[model samples]
Target: MTLLAPGSAQVVAGNRRVGMMALRIAGAVVLLVAVAALVGLLWRPFAFWAAFNPTLLGVLRWTLIGLAVGWAFLFMDAWRLGQPLSLQQNQRLAVVGINGVLCLSVAGALIFGAHVVGVQRDFTIAMSSDGAASAAEDGRYNVLLVGGDAGKGRWGLRTDSMTVASIDEETGRTVLISLPRNMTNFPFAEGSVMDKAWPQGYNCGYPDCELNSVNTWVGENRELFKGVEDPGMNATISAVEGITGLKINYWAMVNLEGFKGLVDAVGGVRLNVRQPIPVGLPNEKTFHYIDPGTRTLNGHDTLWFARAREGSDDYSRMARQKCVMNAMLHQVSPKTMLTNFTEIASASSDMVSTNVPSSEFGRFIDLALKARGQKVSTVSLVPPAVDTSDPDIDKIQEMIQKGIDQAEGTAKAAPKKKKPAGQSGMTGGSLGSLSEGYVANQADDLGAAC
Candidate 1:
């Protein structure tokens, strides 16, 4: 009887209706699970439905919770129907223990799944952006990566590092375009509010107007961008779009100070250090330096490694920041992510604010997985190529287009030339003695260049 029906013992004991109802419920659940599995096998539809619909996700979470409770109750009832009281003590104990273990295992997994769903729900709610999802334009999705800092006593926020990562829609090949923070006399996009406000460019008459200063300026005069969700961000985007000659799809701002916590959460990032880097201001009584070599850096040290300016200029710092970004892209593995998922999520929610909507996470995740296997190229609008102080906008756009073409395989990259030893290959300008192997502004392969 027990072999034919799960609740047959109860039926044999004359609770016929109850036993039949339990069996029906169990059969229905198994059928439902099988159907769900089949649906999951056709993953595209499932992924689209799951990724875009918050209500469906919530319903699924509750369904799992309900199934877990119902299954536990059914298992316990089946055990009760077995008539353990009439069995020998050892046999009864064995049956009871087996049922208990099975119940606990299934319930534990379901509860953990429910917890993960709750975490994802909270994350989506907290981080969902105002921007709408859109397709890649002209075979690329150009995203602005802004490194913002709102340090102690600093008014508002300053975006000191700005890079545009243009990713190929099909191949996942990426080219990072790094703009100098101090670049001046750059145009904002025509018809943009920023352009209307300062038709002559982001020039403030004197030499104080710079690319980085645009954020602060926008913040001071927010009324100029009456309907903008983020005035500073919009202004910066206009400047970047004008400079790069690429349509800006979305932007993500990372708080540099909060970045420390994220690095720690990922355990740490491994970097191949070419030279010793100062960690703090030279004027301070005591300062520490990160010894040169291949080493993993903690959050605090990594921040300094990326932003230290005591013995380095902003250009050198930019080069280091690129190295750091490259290392993070390459070294942090899926296993590391799963191991520290909660910490990483918590830290990221605090660290990053982006206009890339939550619904698009799946798409980006797929792109990131694709990117892992591809070589990343870089082009910077610094020195030799374009003057940071007074840039030639047309020439700058041409350089950027050249890089894009090279990445797309429409044009081959120029051959590398060897530089004489003991001489700085590129002009470091006021920034003295860049780190060894620091290839400024241009590289076919960023990892190898650093």
Candidate 2:
């Protein structure tokens, strides 16, 4: 009776008040869990908050432990109330065994739950950002994503890939704005430290002032960004904001080399192989290739698929990187995340350095979930349409605005940029060559492009 209803034995033995109180607690727990589950499904942001909030998780952990201990005590009290000494030897032994089994099973389940919650708490703490949260700019969150080298230096040093995920705050509709690292003669955000240095734009007689060199420039000219902890990242943000005409809400820098570990943690990501993608560096002797097919690729091959520039231009590599991003969004499931969260979190911590505060996790998580079902849009400032050596900032900003408006259904897409003559062949494991501009670069529907 105690095992079945938690306090029915006490009720039967005339400890009615105590029994009622115990039953109420048990009922409250069940009710709370059920209500939480329902609310979580209806409103995902609540679920995110519950899962990511360290203080709440800590409270939940202690609550589970308390429930386990309290329930065990009630079971023991019920066992005592049974007056086993007056019963048959076999009956006494059976009663004692049942109570022991019930206590262990119930307590064990709660303890396990507590452990899972603790693991999640630790993960949030590990990834916690020191950055202050910012309000969405013009009803959207424009996040700068930088892919750089994995080394001992600053996070923004040598940003090989720079993409901005401008997300709608309400719909989670996204427009990926990619900037070529080699872009030159671009302006910095007005009134920014970099802007003060070169009021006209980031143009020097020498080549050290390219888009990717912002980090190095900041390091050399520390006097410009006084009191800033991550001057390079701030300067980089300024550059992106200036180029895209989108105010950056936050920035995250990921080490390109550490991407392999993140991929492996999710078991692997599925991607349709368009062509034979190279798997090793150009100088590698035992060169291998990821055979063509729709396949699930492990960490190493996937990394190379996105990174390889062998027989491919940087533009093609950028297209493939967007494909990798799309694949990860669709393939990595919520169930897979729950099961392998620790490994995934560890890998992410190693690679990604983000200024997204822990408090905003719920909002971002909800948006990501919403985005999974929507068509992602892309706007790569790449060839044919853009001349990276000296990009047209005014035209690029117009392109960006059109992309955002198209994604939100407020405007029609501009006519596709005409490809150059004889640019029909597929290169860089994507749908089109650099001259033609890969479909993934400027697509209304990213899935078809990939």
Candidate 3:
């Protein structure tokens, strides 16, 4: 046998080594994807138990389940890559496989965290803070859930859906009020384009602003609501306080993207449709017409439900919106969560932004636990209470007085049996009485700051 030259042998060996390294790197990538997927699926289970009592065992169990699902998908991908196809085709197949695992893991994790954070933050604020607890004690806690819709070239944020949620701690009841974006209100904030609402010229020293003007002014000054005027958060919060006749202790503003991510994170929520919604929105937007059934929805479908403005206008959309929320809640409960952790977690990364800190998570959990066996109710601030045609100024004042009376009344009432121990420190002094709820009488027509 002829012996090869030393130089040639070395060059061949080097080529072999390079090929081996490339193969090893590719294998590692696939392995990592599988591991990540497994971790994702088990996130919910891990988080739920973690809330009860976070332990090494819980994490390990969740990780193991995620890995099992991930490995199955990995093998499936590898097989697809091995099929007879062009180099690009094989590459695409591997990517799809990797993405599948990645998405699954992210979904599971996000669902876990959303509930973990949402419940924890909301409840803790309601329980520990005297301000928040008082609102609940007073038979109402108005939660302004604002949805932002910012279009190109627009100077302000458009209110998509303004929902005020009231929780009555005494009865463990919940009432939701939806405000129309176009509803007119007085200029609560001073120096606004509309000034009739503040005829007193901000003399009350309410930050030198009137209630109606507050939203726009705050939007102009606060970096948060960059381009919007009236119905700005401050304005909205104030308006809500005016209408409900109760003090608002907390606010959660969610934008379109965050809403979509939240819906998609938990595999897909199932919603019931009573009527056929028309497809094809204006500007070439393709919308979904949800059929009456137990229909499952991903992010896109959930958005369609939220954005549906045809057929029944706002009322129909409101019904659909509630359905979507209910569906999402059902999908994200503890047991289902354990399996979808990764997807849920990843989706949440895009959906929610709030001021509630992570440290207060445990308190939120306590509230959730307390609310579990309780009843929830819904209320809408539509038609009779206030109308779209009413002048912005007069309507806003009515809302404010309503909030004050409600706040004061709840503060003065004798502590009920259901009042949580040591949870009674809302505002200082007597909150006053709701002797008259929503007084449209001539005497109280003038809106005043609390």
Per-model TM values vs. the true structure: 0.87, 0.90, 0.50
Candidate 2 lDDT over 299-372, as tens digits, reads: 98888899988778989899989999988887788899878887888888788878888889899988888899
Write candidate 1's Cα lDDT for 1-450 as tens digits.
433454565666756887787678668867977887788667644654464456766876887797678667666877877778999999999998988988888777888888777666666667777568978979899999999885653423577799999998877888999999889988989899988988887776444688988878887788898988778888999999888888999988888888999999999999876667777777766568888778899998898888887656777778778888888888888799878877887888888888888777767766776787877888888866677777999999998899989988899989775566776543222222343334745777888766
For each predicted model, how many residue pairs clash, with residues at least 3 apart or on different chains? 0, 0, 55
Displacement of residue 33 (Cα, Å) in model 3 is 29
Which candidate has the top score in lDDT?
2
Error of 3 at 59 (Å): 15
Off by over 4 Å in 1: 1-52, 87-96, 150-156, 205-207, 280-287, 424-440
Error of 1 at 17 (Å): 6.3
* Candidate 3 error regions (>4 Å): 1-141, 150-156, 169-172, 186-217, 220-232, 279-288, 369-375, 391-450
> Any idea what lDDT model 1 has?
0.78
TM-score of 1: 0.87
State which candidate, 1 or 2, has the greater lDDT.
Answer: 2
* lDDT at 359, model 2: 88
Q: Is candidate 2 or candidate 3 better by TM-score?
A: 2
lDDT of each: 0.78, 0.88, 0.46
